[model samples]
Target: MLAVELNGDAVRAKNGSMVAYDGRMGFKRLTGGGEGLRGMVTRRVTGEHMTVMEVKGQGTCYFADRASNINLVRLGGEKLYVEASNLLCTEEGLRTGTTFTGLRGAAEGNGLFTTTVHGTGWAALMSDGPAVILRVAPGLPLTVDPGAYVAHTGELKQQFVSGVTWRTAIGEGSGEGVQLRFEGSGTVYVQPSERTTLGGQL
Candidate 1:
């Protein structure tokens, strides 16, 4: 569970993610991520839809999604890339949008567009289990399974890699075959458990 202390402030959270709240709080559903018509149209066209609600009060508000482990990310003018299903909440001041993700999205079976959060605020991410934070520096690249990738901060490049071989075609492929390679400087959050991806079974 994630708790947000609000002193008459507001927060944007996933719709129906509120578990409990104290003080006088109000919940309102925002259309198009609070961007109004433009956002609604974009989401409708891209197939990357998000249902968000705004919570405002003077006490504390609780949020949870599927009781999954939550990870907090603090962004300072940097973009955070995360899957739409993994995002739980964001500070009201933060901005959310969708971007083209190429083959990585197809490999995950999560569509070709992923969600991005920017600005300085708190963003909550969810995973099947506790997430591991890995630091990638110059020359120290990181490779992650598509199903295991949660979210990442800072500057990074992602590439799709495959381990398909004759054996793989004959049902003897390595268990850890396809992976998402990340290079550059940043922090990556990976969950211990991996969701079943289309390529993961191969």
Candidate 2:
């Protein structure tokens, strides 16, 4: 469960995620994840669907979804790239949109576009377990399994790497056949457990 304290401020959260609240609070369903008509149209066209609600007023609100573990991320004028299903909540000042992720998204079975959040504020992400934060530097790159990926922050370049060979295709190779390679300066969030991704079945 995640607790958010609002003092005359508003926050955007996943619709139907609120479990409890105290004091005066208003919950309004946001059309198109609160990005307005263009954003709604973009989401529809990209296949990255997100249903959001705006929570406002002075009070503490609680949120939970499928009993998933929640991770809080503080952003200071940086962009966050995350899956729509993994994102839980964000401060009202943040801007939500979609970006092309190429083959990485296809490996996860989430399509070619992923959700993006920008601005200075806090956002919450959901994971199968407590998320692990990995740092990437100039020379030190990081590779992650598609099923365990949660979200990433900062400027990072991502590449889809396939270790699949003829042996793998014939079921005589390592299970770790595909991966997402990340380089540059950034931080990645991964879960301890892997989800049922297309890459995981390979």
Give the winner by TM-score: 2
- Cα lDDT tens digits, model 2, 121-141, are 999999999999999999999
**Model 1 poorest ten-residue lDDT run:** 33-42
For the record, the alpha-carbon RMSD of candidate 1 to the native fold, in angstroms, is 1.0
Model 2 Cα shift for residue 128 (angstroms): 0.5
lDDT (10s digit) by residue, model 1, range 64-153? 988899999998889999998899999987999888999888888888888899999999999999999999998999999989999888
Query: Candidate 2: global Cα-lDDT?
Result: 0.94
Q: Pairing residues by index, what is the TM-score of model 1?
A: 0.97
**How accurate locally, in lDDT, is each candidate?**
0.90, 0.94
Query: Which residue runs of candidate 2 sit more than 4 Å off their true CA positions?
Result: none
